[model samples]
Target chain A: MQDLLFYFFAVLTLIFGFLVVVNPFTRSPVTSAMFLVLSIISMSGLFVMLHAFFLAAIQILVYSGAVIVLFLFVIMLMDLKEEARSTFQGIRLTFSLLLAGLFATVLIGVVLTSGLGAEPVVLTLEGSTAVLGERLFNAYIIPFEILSVLLLVGMVGVVLLSKKNLN
Target chain B: MVGLEHYLVVSILLFSIGALGVMLRRNLLVIYMGLEMMLNAANLALVAFSRFNDNINGQILVFFIITVAAAEVAVGLALIVALYRRRRTTDVRELTDLKL
Candidate 1:
């Protein structure tokens, strides 16, 4: 059952991701942005399948919800002139695809040759939100606070950079 | 249950898509989207490892990564907007003022 959902969501994610890359053809940033949001949300579904519910929520909330909205807003604000199309020629693109295939083959080889391997030490982590929260507030507190600081810095930097252009 | 290889293969494919987008696409915004794709591929790998290893720490790190990714998108899009305002184009080849 869960495996079915995983494959379903994974295919959905791959489809939307492909659309996002191709949607630039319409010369519409808004459309591409929307496809990107769908792709992220589908990826979040993959996270949920992995039993990382909190991470899934954060993925959708942060990436699909907040960040993509910001991207759409910027795209709407700008006077995009049907940005120059992708530059890679057919030969180069074919080579890239071939290289990507080669890399995948090598990765599969490594994974297969590494043997089935010992069983992973599966900790008792399910339904343990309390433990997750406690650790977040305790051991991971510094990095957590640093992220907020980083957001602040990013916001201030944006304002300053935009202001420089105006004056 | 889905095995770890399934997750690993999906992530590798997604990461390659991002890399190809970066290498082949000429638009800055599209390239930024590609970067997001790469980050997401990494996030998938992290959560998959967390699941297979049965540890919450990996998921916790994913939370931090999401935070950083949000900030990165904000900053990157803002810069793209600024660049658009100044140059009127998002073409990578043309935005070479500081390329030296």
Candidate 2:
């Protein structure tokens, strides 16, 4: 049962993710954004399978709920039309694909040959919310505080950048 | 039974696809989405390793990563929007004013 569920979500994730990148049917950014939402949801399913329940919920809320909506809002605000299909230069496209393929080959080769371990170890600690919160507030308190400051800076910077006339 | 390698392989493939999108797409928004995909791929790998290693730290790192990603997307989209307003197009090939 678990194996079947894993395969289902995994395939869904890859498929939607692919659509986000290279949808043959449409060149609209909105379609890609929507596909990205589906991909993110399926990834959260994989997170749940890994027993990181808190991360799964956070992934759904933060990613699909907030982030993708932001993308849609921007897309709507921009009123972007479907991109022309001929934008892809043949040589550049070929080079990009070749480079990406090379990267994936190297990484996958390292992963397969690293021989970390085939057998799954029994998880002694599940990533429940309470434990994650404790760790965040305890061991990682400084970084957490810094992250908040970074977010504040990001917010201010965004507002400044979006202003029509910076006086 | 899905092992860590299975999860890692998925993560690798997703990252590769994201990289391809970033390279292949002309629209800046699509490129940004590709960046998000790449980040999510890294997050998946971290969670998988966390589970197999029986450590919560990797998950904790993912939490930080997600927060950072949220901020990045907000700022990045604003930049894209601002650029669009000035340039009136989202095609990367045309935004070459900085090219030397």
**Which candidate's lDDT is highest?**
2
Model 2 TM: 0.97
What DockQ would candidate 1 receive versus the native complex?
A: 0.62
lDDT per residue (tens digit) for residues B40-94 in model 1: 9988988887777777788888788888888788778878888888788888888
Q: Highest DockQ: which candidate?
A: 2
In the range B40-95, model 2's lDDT, one tens digit per residue, is: 99999999999999889999999999999999999999999898998899989899
* Candidate 2: clashing residue pairs, number: 0
Measured against the true two-chain complex, the DockQ scores of the candidates, in the order shown, are 0.62, 0.83
Residues A1-167 of candidate 2 have per-residue lDDT tens digits of 99999999999999999999888888999899999999999999999999999999999999999999999999999877778888676898899989989999999999999886666577676899999999999999999999999999999999999999878
Alpha-carbon deviation at B30 in model 1, angstroms: 1.1
- Residue B79 CA error for candidate 1 (Å)? 1.4
Specify the poorest-scoring 10-residue window by lDDT in model 1 chain A.
A115-124
For candidate 1, give the lDDT: 0.78
